[model samples]
Target: MGGLTTAAILSDLGRKVCVLEQHYTAGGFTHSYERAGYEWDVGVHYIGEVGAATRTRKMFDYLSNGQLEWAPMADEYDRFYVGDKVFNAVAGKDEFRNNLIRQFPNETQAIDLYMRLLDRTGDALSAFGMGRGMSKLQRFAMKPWTAWKLRGAFRRITYDVLSDLTDDQDLIATLCGQWGDMGMPPRRSPFMAHAMIARHYLYGGYYPVGGSWRMAETIIPKIQAAGGEVFTYAKVEKILVENGRVAGVEMKDGHRIRCDCIISSAGVDNTFSHLLPEDVAIKSGYRQRLTSVTPSMAHLGVYIGLKGTAEELGLPKTNFWIYPGNNYDKAVDAFMDNPDAPFPVVYISFPSAKDPDYENRHPGTATIEIVAPAPYERFEKWREETWGKRGDDYEALKEALGSRLMETLYDKLPHLRGKVDYYEVSTPLSTNWFGGYQRGELYGLEHSQQRLKQDWLRPKTTIPGLWLTGQDVLTAGVTGAMMAGLITTMSMVGARKMGPLLRRIYA
Candidate 1:
C-alpha cells in the first residue's frame, strides 16, 4: 500500500515511478489466495474509517479513483471473548461509549477520560508524523511547540496511561483487546499508537467490497496512467551505493535497475541489514540503530474452508478476539515465555461474512482466518527449508497447532464443528516465505515505546536518494502505511511541490 500509494502520487506529479515487489503478487499483506474453490484475505480482515467520507476515506477514493468500495460490517463490528465473558464493540461513538458504560457502570469517569485521550491523540499523531519527515532544523524549530501540544502522550506507555484511569483490569484489557492490531501488548506499546488505533475504529469496521486486493487493483492503474508500472517477483537482492549515496538496485536474477533515486517500501530491516551494503549500513549508523528496535510479533494463521456459505455457517460479520483472561499483558508474557501456555490472544475473522461480494467470488463456500501470535524462534529450525516443502516434522507441528486453533473456533461456534472441509496452518516461516519478513513479523517493526521513539524511522534516511516508507516508517495498518506513503512523498518532493496534490487528495 505504501509503495503503491507513493507511486500514484509521484506519477500524478509527472515523475515516472516503478514498484518492484519481491512477492509474486502485489498488495503485500492485502493480497488474497484461493484454494479448493475457497478464497481468503491474509492481512486485511477489517478496516476502519472508510465507511464514510472522512480524510481516510477520501484518500482511498483518490487512490482507487473511486473504483474501490467498502461494505460496512455489523453495527457490533468487534466481538471480544475474554475468558468466559463476551463483549461487543458496537458501532458509532455514542453507542460504543454507552455500551462500555453499560458493561462497567461504575467506571464512567475512567471511560470518559479514555475517550478524551483518544480525541487528544489526533493532535499528537499529527505532530509526531510531521516530526518524522522534517529536517533537523525544521524539527528543532517545532520541537517545543509539538511537545507542548502532544503532552508526552507519544512517550508514555499505553498500560501505564490507561491503568492510571482505573483499577479494574478487565476494563483495561477490554479497551486494549485490539492490541494485536499493532502487534504489541499495551504494557509495552506506546500510548499514542493505542489512541490512534482506538479512534480509527470508533465508528465501525469496514471490508473492501469484492476483496482486499481491489485496493491495489484500483490504485495500480493510477500509477500506470502516469507512465509508471508495478512489477511482481522483481526481487531486489541489494541496494547499490557509490560515493555514500544510493545508485540503484541489483536483482537476484543478476539484473540491474540503475536510477539516481530509490524509494524502498521493502521495510527497514531488509533495506538496511539485507539490501544495503554491509559497510554502508554500518557507516550510516543504521546497523547500530537497528539494535534499539525489535521485530514485531510473528503469528500463526489458521485458514479454514467450509463447504457451506457464510450465511449457512452462521458466521457473523463481527470479528472475534478471544483471550484467556483480562490480564492481557500477563497472558502474553506467559505465552511468550512458554509456548505451551494458552494463546495470549486468538483473533478470528470471517472474511466471507464481511465481504458482500464473496458469494459471487466463491459461491457455496465460507472461509475463516484465525491468527495468534507465535514466536519466530519456534520455527527457527526450519528457516533454511523451502516453503510448502518443510517435510513431515513441519507438517506435524502445523497440524497440531492448527487443530488447537480450530478447537477455539468450534468452542465459540459449536454448530460448525464438523463443517470444515479443509484447513492449513501458516507459521512465522510462512510470513517470511510470502511477505519477505526475515523474522516473519506480522508488523514490520515492533510498536514498543522504544521503537516508536526512534526519530530515524522516517522517509528521508541519512543515505541520499534512498527513501523509506511502510509500516516501519509510521504506525501499522493499511491506512497507516498509506499515510506514511503520503508523508514520504511530501518529504521527497517538498511541501510546496506536493501542496496541490495534497489538496486534491483531501478535496
Candidate 2:
C-alpha cells in the first residue's frame, strides 16, 4: 500500500515512478486470493473516515480518479465479546458515547474524558507527522514546540493513561477492544497509538465496493498514465551503494536496475538487516538502532468458504472480537506461555457481508476470515521448509488450530455449524513466505512507547538517495501507510511545491 500510494501520488505530480513487487501479485497486504470459488482479503478488513468527504476520502478519490467507492457497514461496526459480556461501538460519535454510557452509566465521566483525550491525541498526531516531513534543521528549530504538543498522551503508555481515568477493568477492555487493529495489547502500546485507532473508527467502518483488490486496481492506472510501470515477482536481492549513495538494486536473478533515487517501502528490518550492505548499515547506525525496536506479534489466519450467500446464511456486516477475559495483557502472557491456554484475542470478519458487490463477483458464495495471535517461535522450526510442502506434522498442527477457531465461530452462530464448505489455515511461516517478514511480524515494528519515540524512522535516511516509506515510518493500517507516503512526498519535494499540490488534491 505504501509503495503504491507513493507511486500514484508522484505519478500524479508528473514524475514517473516504477514499483517492483516481490510477490506474484501487487498491493502487499491489500491483495486478495481465491480458492474453491471463494476470495478473501488478507489484511484490509475495514476502513474508517472514508464514508464522508474527509481528507482520507479525498486522497482515495484523487488516487483512484473517483473509480473507487465505499459501502458502509452496520451502525454497530465492532462487536466485542469479553469473557461472556457483550459490548459494541456504534457509528456516530454521540451514539458511541451514549451506548457506552448506557452500558456503564456510572462511568459517564470517564467516558467523556476519554473522548476529549482522543480529540487532543488527534492534534498530537498531526504534529508528529509534520515533524517527520521536516528536515533535520527544521525539526531542531521546532523541537520545543513539537515536544510540548506531544507531551500528553503521545509520550505515555496506553494502560497507564487509561488507568488514571477509570478503575473499571472491563471498561478499559471495552475501550481497547480493537487492540488487534494495531497488533498490540493495551499495557505495552503507546496511548497515541491507541487513541489514533480509536478516533479513526469513531465515525464507522466501510469496505471497498467490489473487494479490497479494487484499491490497487483503481490506483494502478494513475501510475501507468504517467508512463510508469508496476512489475510483480521482481524480487530485489541487494541495494547497491557507491561513494556513500544509492546506485540501484541487484535482483535475485543477478540483474540490476540502476536508478539514482531509490525509495524502499520494504521495511526497516529488511532494509537494515538483509538488503543493505553490512558496512553501510553499521556506518549509518541502523544496525545499532535496530536493537531498540522489536517486531510485532505474528498471527494465524483461518479462511472459510460457505455454500450459501451472506444474506442467505445470515451473516452480519459487523466484525466480532472475542476475548477470554478483560485483562488483555495478562491473557496474552498466559497464552504465549501455554498454547493450550485460551486465545488472547480472536477477530472474525465477514468480508462477503461487508462488500455490497460480493454477489456480483462470486454469486451464491460467502467467505469468512478469523485471525488470532500466534507466536512465530511455534512455527520457527518450519523456517527451512517450503510453503505448501512443509510436512505432515505441520499440516496436522494447522488443522488443529483451524478446528479450534471454527469451534469459536460455532459458539456464536450455532446454526452455521455445518454450513462451511471449504477452509484453510495459514501460519506465521505463511506470512514470512509471502510478505517477506523474517519473523512474520504482522504490523512491522511494535507500537510501543519506545518505538514511537524513535525520531530517526523517517522518509529521509542517512544514506543519500535512499528513502523509506511504509507503516514502519508512521503507524499501521492502509490509511496510515497512505499518509506516510504523502509525508514522504512532502519531504522529497520542498514545501513551496507541495503547497500547490496539496491544495490541488484536497481542494
Candidate 3:
C-alpha cells in the first residue's frame, strides 16, 4: 500500500521516487500466489469502508486512473458460526443492521448503539485522517502528550463502551467477528480501533477485481507514468544516516541510493529494530512509546488448494468467522500455547468465490485461507543470530498447523476432503524472517488508547531529514498504510495542498 500510494502521490508531485521491495513480488501480503491453478490472497481477505460512492472509492478511482474494478459482495457477505447458531451477514448498509436486529430481537437498542459508535469512529478519523500538515497547529498542541492520545483513550475505546451498550454476549461476539483485522482481542484492543474498521465496511465490504495484487499492479503504472520506479527483490540492508539524519539506503548488494526522505510501510518494529542502527540515539518520547507499548497479534494462515469447483465442493461467498466454542479468549489462548489444540478461532475465506474467473482460469480449482491469531513466543525460542534464516522446525510447525486446517476444511466441506491438491501454513517465524516484521505482529503497535506512538511513528522524527510511515502511523491494512503514505508526502510538500490535491485528482 505504501509503495503504491507513495509512488502515486510523489510521482504526481513531480518528485522522482523508487520503491524497493524484498519479495520477488510487490504488494507484500496483498500479492497473491499461484500454485498449480489456484490463486489466493495472503492478506486482505476483505476490505471494508470502501463503498463505491464513498470518498475511499473516489480516492481509489483517481489513484488507479479508473483502471481498477470493484465487485460488490453478495447478500450476507460474511457468516458467523458460533456454537450451533449461524448468523448470516447480508450486504447493503440498512440491510446489515436490520438483519442483526432480527437475529437479536431483544437487544435492538444495543445493536443500534453499536452501529452508532461504529459511525462515530469513522467520523473521528476526520480529526486525524487528513495529512498532518492540514492540522500542524493541532499536532503541535498535542505533541507533549505524544505518549498518550485522544486524552481519554479508554473512554473513547474500551470494553466499557461495548459492555455499557449491550448485555448480549453472543451478539457482542458476532459484532466483533472481524477482530482478527485489529489483531488484538476485545479486552486489549480499543473501541475506536473497532469502530474505524467496522463502520468503514458497514455499507458492506468489497472484493477487488482480479485479486488484491491488482490493487498494487494498477497503482504501479500510475506511479511510473508520474515518473517513479518500483524495484523488486532489492533489499535495503540498512538506512544510511549522516550526523543522525537519514541520508539514503544501503542495499544488501552494497549499492546505495540517496533520497531526501524515507517512508517505511514496513511494520514499526521492523523499521526501528532492524533497518535503523541498533543503538541509535533515542530522540524523544516516540522511541519510549514504542518500547513501552505491546505489539499487535500475529497470525497463522493455512492456504489450501482444492481439486474441485467451489460450488460442487460447497463454498460460501462471504468469509466464515468460525470459533470452535464460544470461549473466545480461552480458545485463542489454547491455540497459541498448543498449535494442536482442539477448536480454535478460525476465519475462512475463498478468493475464487469472490472472483469466479480465477476459477475459470483454473477450472476445478478452489482456494481457502483459514487464519487464527498466534503468539510470537511459540517460535520465539528460535530467535537467535540467524535473523533472516528459515529453519527445519519452522516448516514442521507450519505443517502441523496446515494439517489441522485441512481437517477443519474437510469437516466443513466434506466433498473437498480428498479433493485438496496442495496446502501450506505461514507462521510468525516466516512473517518475521521473510516479511521483516519483528515478532510477527501483522499491524504495528497495538492501539490501546494509551501510549499512542504519536511522535515517533508520524512523518516527523527526532533526527533531521528522517521520518516514519506505513502501518505504524496509520495502523495496518491497505487504507491505513496509504494514509501514512499521504502524510509522508505532505510532510515534504506543503500540508495545505492535501485537500486541494484530492479535489485535483477527482477533477
Q: lDDT per residue, candidate 1, 1-507, as tens digits? A: 989988998998999998999888899998988888888888998889987889899999999999999999999998888889987788888899999999999999999999888888778888888888888899999999888877855578888998889998889988997888987788888888888888899999999999999999999998999888999999999999999889999999999999989989888999999999999999999999999999989999998999989998899999999999988889989999999899999999999998999999888999999999998999999999998899999999999999899999999999998899998899999999899999999989988888877989999998999999988998889998999989999999999999988788887
Runs of candidate 2 with Cα error greater than 4 angstroms are: none
lDDT order, best first, reads 2, 1, 3
Give the Cα lDDT of each candidate: 0.91, 0.93, 0.72
lDDT by residue for model 2 (227-330), tens = 99999999988999999999999998999999988888898999999999999999999999999999999999999999999999999999999999999999
Please write out the lDDT profile of model 3 over residues 90-167, one tens digit for every residue: 776678889999999999898887776655554456555543433457667755543243334333544557778877
In model 3, the worst 10-residue window by lDDT is 146-155
* TM-score of structure candidate 2: 0.99
Which residues of candidate 3, in runs, are more than 4 Å off?
131-136, 140-158, 279-287, 337-339, 381-393, 451-453
List TM-scores for all candidates, in order. 0.99, 0.99, 0.91
Report the error of model 3 at residue 186, Å.
1.4
What's model 1's lDDT at 108?
100
